[model samples]
Target: MEFLDEIKAKFPNVLESVDGSNENESVLLLKDKTKIKRVCKEVKNHFDILFMLMAVDKPPKIFELNYVFSSYKTQNILTIRVNIERDKAVIDSISSLFESADWEERETYDLFGVEFIGHKNLKRILLPEDWPGRPLRKDFEVTDEVRNWTGLDLKF
Candidate 1:
C-alpha cells in the first residue's frame, strides 16, 4: 500500500475515493479526467504494465473508465477509475506512458467513442473508420444505415 499512500499524499485533490478492501487489488477513483495523464506519469514506476483499459457505459450520463495496472514484483494490481460525462467522452491519453495503452485506448475509442488526447495514432482499431456510431454505447441504435453498412439489408 506504499504506492497508494504515495499517490494519496501527492494528489489528494484529484482522487475522489480509495477502496482498499481487497488484498492484492486497490481501486482509486479520480475526480478529474484532465489530471489522469499527470497521475499516470507520477505512478508509472510503481507498476510494471498497464494490464487493461476498459469502460462501462452507464447510460444517460456517465462512462466509468477503469485502468488496470499490474506489477510483476509485487504480484499486485491497481485500478484507477474515472467517471466522465457520456456526452463529452474525452480523456487524456496515457499511451505515452504505457505502450499497451496504445491499442487498448484505440479499441476503447473505436467501440465507445472515447477521444484520448495525446495518443499518437488515436484511430479505430477494430472497426472501419466510417462506421456510423459507437456501437458499444448503450444508446446506440441499430438502424438501416448500420444494416446497409454490414450488408444485412441484402435480400437472398
Candidate 2:
C-alpha cells in the first residue's frame, strides 16, 4: 500500500483532504488538532523526517498550521495543514515526537501567537517576552514605543 493510501485508510476521519501535484509531493489536511502528534508519529515511523513547521495567517480569523515531512527513503514530501480559529489558536505539541519542533513551535507561538498545547517550554523563541503582539498576524500594528525606539515615522 502507498503512503497516502495507508494514511487515508488509517485516518479517514481525521484527514479532511489530500492534494499534490504528484505522488512525491502530496499534502494532507488533518481536521483535528488533537491527533497531530499521533499522525506525526506515524509519519516518523515511516522514516519521514519532520523538516519544517510553520504557521500562516489567513485573514479575518483563521490560522493555518503547516507541517512538512520528508522521507529520504521514498523521496516523498508530505505537508500537513491544520486550520484553527485565530481567537482560539491552540494545537497539540509535536515537540515530543520531533525535537526540532520545540524551537519551531516556539517561533510560531512567538510570531503568530498560536499556542502549542503540552509544549514543555512554550515561550518566546525570537521576540522578547514583553513584545506587544504577534508580529506576523495580519492585524498587528506598529506600536508607538517601537517607532520611538527606532526613530522612524512610518504608519501601519
Candidate 3:
C-alpha cells in the first residue's frame, strides 16, 4: 500500500489510480501510453518479475492492455493497465525492459491488433502473416473460408 502511495506521489501525472482490492493486488492505471516504458522501468525497480502481458477488447471501441508483475522480495503483485483507442491502438513496447514481453507483445499484436510501437520484431506470433483480421476483436467474424477449412458449420 505504501509502495503504491509512493509511486502515486512520485509519478502523479502518469499514474491515474490505484486499486486496493482483489487480494491486495495493486492495479495501476496509466494515463499516458507513451510513458509506459519509463513507468515500467520504475516499476521494475520494485517488481522484479513480469508475470504476463495481454490485451482485451472492450466493445464499442476500446482496447485495454494489462501487464502483470510481481515482487519476489515483498511478494506483491502489481498490474499496469493502459487503455488504447480501438482505431489507433498503439503503445510503447516494454520488451526491452522485460525479455518475456517479446512474445507476449507479438501475441497481443497478432490477436488483438494492439501494436507495440517500439517492438523490434512486431509481427504475428500465433497466426499467419496473411491472416485476414485480428481474431480477438469483438467484431471479428468467422468467415466461411475458415469454417470450411476447419470442417465446422459455423453459423457466425
**TM-score, one value per model:** 0.90, 0.88, 0.88
- Residue-level lDDT of model 2, residues 83-155, one tens digit each, is 8998999899998888888899999999998988889999998876776678889988887876555434678
Q: Where does candidate 1 stray beyond 4 Å?
A: 151-156
lDDT of 1 by residue, 1-156 (tens): 788888878897887556554757888899988899988987787888999998999998999999999999998898999999998998999998999999999999999999999899989999888777899999989988787786345777
Which window of ten consecutive residues has the lowest lDDT sum in model 3? 16-25
Tell me the lDDT of model 2 at 27. 77
Clashing residue pairs in candidate 1 are none
lDDT of 1 at 144: 82
Clashes of 3: 0
* Ranking of candidates on lDDT, top first: 1, 3, 2
Per-residue lDDT of 147 in model 2: 54
lDDT of 1: 0.88
- Write model 3 residue lDDT over 53-120, tens digit each, in one string: 87888998789888999888889998988888999988888999998899999999999888888799
Q: Against the unseen true structure, what C-alpha lDDT does each candidate score? A: 0.88, 0.83, 0.85
Off by over 4 Å in 2: 149-156
Best by lDDT: 1
